[model samples]
Target: MNKKREIQSSVKDESLIEKRRAQMIRGAVTLFKQKGFHRTTTREIAKAAGFSIGTLYEYIRTKEDVLYLVCDSIYDEVHARLESLDIEKGSLEVLVTALEHYYGLIDDMQDEFVVMYQESKSLPKDALQYVLKKELEMVALFERLLTECRESGELKMTPKEIKLAAHHLFVQGQMWAFRRWALRDFTISEFIQTQTNFLLQGMAGEKISTQGAK
Candidate 1:
């Protein structure tokens, strides 16, 4: 009975630690997004997280460490979402649906995504490389999806064209997050529908409509 109680106590402590870590990450993401990484300080992050500077240091070594943590978490979430998508069936429809889901996920993680996008270059060499590697993996995932679409005859672009198109498509998605203040007036479903139609019609070798219709 004593051993069982001790085990329960340990589990509770671990859960509390995870809760605190998540809170810190959430706070750090907001600060980093609002004030860019260079402008934000560890002390600010600590205060925002409702913890002392010393306690913040106990969990994260520096402001950069917090950036890395936030980015890693964001990327992990994206990778998980991508992994669950069924890219093998109805490749074009799957890609459209996956992209819509991707946009929603990134929108939900807007703070972290924005911070990482804007401030990853400020990291030290090794840390910047680590972040870029994760970003490249994401890029490759999209490229693969584009390639599958082209091979499946769902898209008419050549390999080189597909790669370029994928890059542009990604940039368009990023614009939705980066320009959310201006885009906030537009709903996510509207943005997804508009963007998806734009990409699909263009990739299908059709001319883009000026009035935003396919």
Candidate 2:
């Protein structure tokens, strides 16, 4: 498990800290989507979160801390959604369903996804590394599923190929949010169907339509 980076807080109650931070993340992510991280002020974040500036400062010292918290919350949600998939079964059908769920997640959180993708780089060095590590944890979920498929003879990929394929799968999901202008013509289901077919064809050498999976 990745150790969460300790954010300095004046509050003593752990549950209160979590509760306030969730409010902070919800508020900050919206402002981040509206105004890029550098342009948004800590005062604005506090107001958006329905609290005073002093209350926000009690939870975080710097605006960057809020960004880190937002990024952390986003990854936690993404991991929870992906973790529920039947990756252990390792069939091509299972893999395709996983991709569908992942793409759907990205679609559902497009604003949040765009904010994290664009503003995460503004975090401090340590916070940025923590966020990147969280990203790899997500990729590893896909890697494990792909490895299981290979072990079960459902996918004919070498270990190296599996690693690259997993990274590709992770990035392709991000493309929907990162390049929405280019992909505006494709609906979420269409995007899922098209990408799943492409990925499965390369990994399993069999084309599978995910239209029904949509």
Candidate 3:
């Protein structure tokens, strides 16, 4: 998803660039959580990373580059953890477990999600498009699961319906973050249980009981 993010810098040492960027990203995430990307200055990010402004510029071109780095890192973490699940099983049970696992990850990284939602518009057009493309890949995971369900005759839905179902699954997972403040009384497990039930029943006649899906 972070393909070709060649952030131009005069630094020629690739290893040092990676190390410095990682430090910058960690520091930037903390700062972004406290003061949004819009409010943060390049000097502040440099100070947070324990570097001088000149050193910070060695890895990043501008403050927007750091924002892109932070967002890219978050998505990378999300994708890595999500890919660890038995997603290849392509069953309702697998999908349920994946959803529950993802909900947990989102809850754990709520601050990062909040920052991303509030500041992603600050990303450059190319960076925003890259992020959106990665998101589409995540939604496609659900589409694959639905296709397998259809093949197994566990659900009956048309291609267009399957496409919409994929989108629903992705958006619902995101809604947990987007609406979390308004739904503070709700737990991630409850969100997973209720939303999974809704999707399962809506897609098929049977409600998937993820109680045994753990």
Best by lDDT: 2
Candidate 3 local lDDT, 21-55, one digit each (tens)? 99898788788988888788889889989999999
Better model by TM-score, 2 or 3?
Answer: 2
Q: Which digits, one per residue and each the tens of the lDDT, describe model 2 over residues 74-148? A: 788887776777777776777777888788888887878899889988999999999999999989988999999
TM-score comparison, 1 vs 3, better candidate: 3
Candidate 1 lDDT tens digits, 1-214: 0011011112335667567668778888888778878888899989999989877766655677777677777777778887887665537767776677678787788777788888877776777777677766777677888888778877777778877876777668877778899987788778877887787777886643323322
Model 3 off-target regions past 4 Å? 9-19, 86-88
The lowest-lDDT stretch of 10 consecutive residues in candidate 1 is 1-10
* lDDT, candidate 2, at 154: 82
**How far off is residue 74 in model 2, in Å?**
1.8
Model 3 earns a TM-score of 0.85
lDDT of each: 0.72, 0.87, 0.82
- The TM-score-based order of candidates, best leading, equals 2, 3, 1
Q: Estimate each model's TM-score.
A: 0.82, 0.91, 0.85
lDDT, residue 92, model 2 = 70
Predicted model with the maximum TM-score: 2
Ranking by lDDT: 2, 3, 1
